[model samples]
Target: MYFNNNLKKFMKENEISLNQLANICELSINTLRELKNNPSHNTNLSSLVILAQALDCSIKDLIEDDIATINFEKVAEKNKNNRLFIRQQVFSPENVQYLRNLFLQVGVPCNISSYGRYKTASVKNEYELSSIKVDFNLRVLDLKECTILQIVDFYVSVNQLLLNEAVIKDTLIKAFETYARKLKLNQIHFIIDRDYERQDDQYSNEHSELQAYFTYTLGTESMLFVQNNYERSPFPELEEYQIEWRKTLS
Candidate 1:
């Protein structure tokens, strides 16, 4: 669990400088910087109250729980399909460096991009066998069906140690919600693919046995509010199975 302070966003929106805010809150500049740099740090409640009063916003508006950094890139290639690809990466401060090292060790390329604390991977092969690719394809198809002609091929990938599936899902939901809200999108669509595979010892000991399902969501109120799961074989060529979700923001 992590908490994010929206001090930078609030400062930018209100055109308030760090010095000015410190003065307004009657706090030292070092203290303000500490709070801004580390929201998860254990600090006095009075500091938050003073900052909230100085910023003229509620405490909730300035702080949020389980906030992760998200980054996206628009990918398009004329030689292949005419679909646009939105490559997204999500991570938290604690895992940012770990993800970077993991990606490097896995030989995944980097595009030299950063958003908040997350960085983008340069190669699509990082998520080639993952359900993220399938979900991205589904989201692109959904947009085209909705008459969204300027659809970009969506390619999203994230680098993290294999944690519990539930934790990853929750992190993905929060990241997508932040991205959608950042773009001021009222409606979005996401397709989540969960891949399962097994080696068939009874059938010549081949590693061809596989099953997969997709969870679809057309979100208006919240990203994870409505979901429907369907069983299907979305990708057959991929060997290692991984699950992920992609969103179509409009």
Candidate 2:
């Protein structure tokens, strides 16, 4: 189950606007805005303490349990014997060039080679999705050693060109599900980076750069955050915020 902030309810009971609360708590409005918009967003513990104090409530009262329960055991049993078909093949020069061209059309750049092991699968409408990139690093403990797979990159040039955001999300979920089942793995993870850039001269309009890490269990519809860190980590160059996800294969 997901736990969300009770900021809205607290504010309503106190008859205070976001700005008023921000001023009272000595917090920037942007932080409050993010909290209001994203229910699953992990707010800092300090901020939560401040908010709870200001609202005259316990920290527990400021959090609401609204997520559905997951049955990990049942899911594990369902996928216990599955295995993915992976083959190691070198990509020809012609194939590499073809992939580069396709990614270019979608504002994504890439280099393809035959050096890495690849997993190919079919998505919606029998659309062939080949050369799915898998990263073996960034291992998590929930999955057995050397068994965890991180989908570092995936590209569907055709879908990128033709599908909308909602459809694309569904397709990706389906792709993850297929991989988990075939690979006989319990969990899969995704790391997405959103760049922050200024378009106009106004600095206030700039949004903070963020990284979203997601973990999906096989046969589940929701993407849950298994671990998330907002403070600086060892890899500051990569992201200021870190998120981790873990899904059960059962």
Candidate 3:
């Protein structure tokens, strides 16, 4: 359950900012920031209670009813270890369990050997998710090069998180859903095509920029002070957002 799809809508209607909402709701800015930014991040029911109360709505209004939504993800950064540094830390049994929990929460199946270190000096923490889910009633048909007569599932993969150009979380799930409903279109493809490569100044129309589709990089704490472009996504939270639509260019 993610608030990125719905929280912004409520905030917009109320004409509030994170700081304002934080003061009004008695919820810390940090917690509210996470709720607003990280679609992959979940919060406790108690915080939901405070938020629903402050927003004058129920918990359901905040995180349930996922119909007519746009999904958000982080385009993973490549593991450029460079073999320059061997930073090693032993994964505690509890640490391994926590990781397993996170994977399960994301619906990712992972293989972590509790004792595999003995089998070999090295092991890979690999996970593959093909046939990643798209919103059943996707709100946008923003594909760059592709056209379809009717709604159809576009096959894609969550190839292990790798670096991509840019990222913007889809905080406008409601808006996109409305757009999809009007156009009778479903599914959003995160294509790294010409449209995206082109700078905003290169286009006369801003909508063509593909701001809704996103890619992400691993962010650092120093970036925390950067002003967020809400028009982007409510994500790149875990710093792993990459969705690709493939084709053969002639």
Tell how far residue 112 is off in model 2, in angstroms.
8.1
List, residue by residue over 59-168, the lDDT tens digit for candidate 3: 87777353212221111112123111111112223333444455444443444343322111111224422112222111112245432111112111222233122211
- Candidate 2 clash pair list: 2-67, 75-250, 76-250, 83-182, 84-182, 90-114, 91-114, 186-249
lDDT of each: 0.41, 0.42, 0.37
Q: Judge candidate 2 at residue 27 and give its lDDT.
A: 67
Query: For candidate 2, what is the TM-score?
Result: 0.28
* TM-scores vs. true structure, each candidate: 0.29, 0.28, 0.28
Which of 1 and 2 is ahead in lDDT? 2
Q: How many times do residue backbones clash in model 2? A: 8
TM-score of candidate 1 on Cα atoms, chains taken together: 0.29
Q: Write the per-residue lDDT of candidate 2 for residues 39-107, one digit (tens) a residue.
A: 447666677888888777898877765332112222323445533222111122333344345434433
Model 2: residue 150 alpha-carbon error in angstroms: 0.8
Model 2 ranges off by over 4 Å: 1-114, 117-146, 153-162, 196-242
Order of candidate numbers by TM-score, starting with the best: 1, 2, 3
Clashes of each: 7, 8, 14
Model 2 lDDT at residue 55: 71
lDDT of 1 by residue, 40-59 (tens): 46556677788888888888
Give candidate 1 regions above 4 Å deviation: 42-44, 65-250
